[model samples]
Target: MKQTNLEMTHNHLKSIVMAIAMIICIQNANAQFANSFGKQKSGKQHPVRVYFMAYDMQYPGIAIGPEYDFLYATHQKIQCNKGTRYTDKHLYFVPQFGIVKTDVQSVAAFVNIELDFKTIYQSGFIVDLFASAGYAQIFENQPADLGASSFENSLFASHGAFFPQFGIGTGYDFRREFNTPIQVNFRVLSASVDMKEFIKPGLNLGITYNL
Candidate 1:
């Protein structure tokens, strides 16, 4: 009986030891995996993400046949991101579709880039300036519903041309830059063909994710 009791105690202690060893091994493996992933992230650029922007602005200067121009319009855009946080620069090709109240078909595209003016590693709010150039084509498609259901018409602005774009924005991180995945930002963009004729100006209030 004494021998059996001793054997049981020894076995229990050995089992506890083995269990502790296994746990340690698992923890080590997890740490290594996380470290490797971090390295991979650092080496690559723009991990490839999809972003969407929903914006609303007043659509001014629309000719409604018998000399009527109005305001107040809403627009939407969906974009693919080729943006890198480390570089503090991003490029997006956005396809935008909008309606000018009741008679105009508003379609345009833009490619913009955000550049960080300050160091990305710095804490607090970082104000950045951005510039982008693209084409804005206004088209008039035959009518069915929703602003005449336009495809691409000559009455619209040139569908393809180089335009000048300029904007200013600020970026805020909740925690530190490297540790956070979600960021919030606000920016205003104006695309212009000449110095005076503006294609469009939009304000974007959106979120960004870092993978």
Candidate 2:
């Protein structure tokens, strides 16, 4: 019975991940299709950005983490009044190391992703949508809860279980030259444990610097 429950949890998580991925793909495809009919230009660019973000989660608590993001052009460039812009596809990899400050103090690590909208060396207003999937490792100081029940133990084990996260936000770019550009954004963050069986949402204020 326990094994059956675990398998069901894994299956459900897989479905949620697949659905989110498909939505992201469809959005990108539509953007590409629209660009295909517009004026074309020659010039390719790749940009890398790093960020320091602070988040408040409804489940475990609050934490701060670092993120890395990069983008590659989609082979076709479209014209903009400023000049020309390319449909740059972005991929983000972020590892969050944080300390939960709730009644249950714990340390956790979460891996996250965010899709950014921008072009090389061009910046003004910006927006990004993000998602994350990972496990949280929790610890308690009191020894009384050591030999808890199987269900409780499994739920809050030293090595925790799966969790899924999603977020969206809008911000602005400094557009500075000969200096590092900065982005400030406000985001609505969310996550779930035991698949979508239990879910929570929160908020995040972040700052990103382009390299």
Best by TM-score: 2
Weakest 10 consecutive residues of candidate 1 by summed lDDT: 63-72
What are the lDDT figures for the candidates, one per model? Answer: 0.38, 0.47
What does the lDDT read for residue 25 in candidate 1? Answer: 53
TM-score of 2: 0.49
What's every prediction's RMSD, in angstroms? Answer: 27.6, 9.8
TM-scores, all models, native as reference: 0.43, 0.49
Candidate 2 on 128-185: residue-level lDDT in tens?
Answer: 6677665544343434344556554333333444656676767665653335456666
For 59-171, candidate 1 gives per-residue lDDT tens digits of: 33211000000111112233437432232322232222222221244433332222223223235354646564433233334444355323322232223334455667676
The clash numbers for all candidates, in the given order, read 3, 0
lDDT, residue 47, model 2: 26
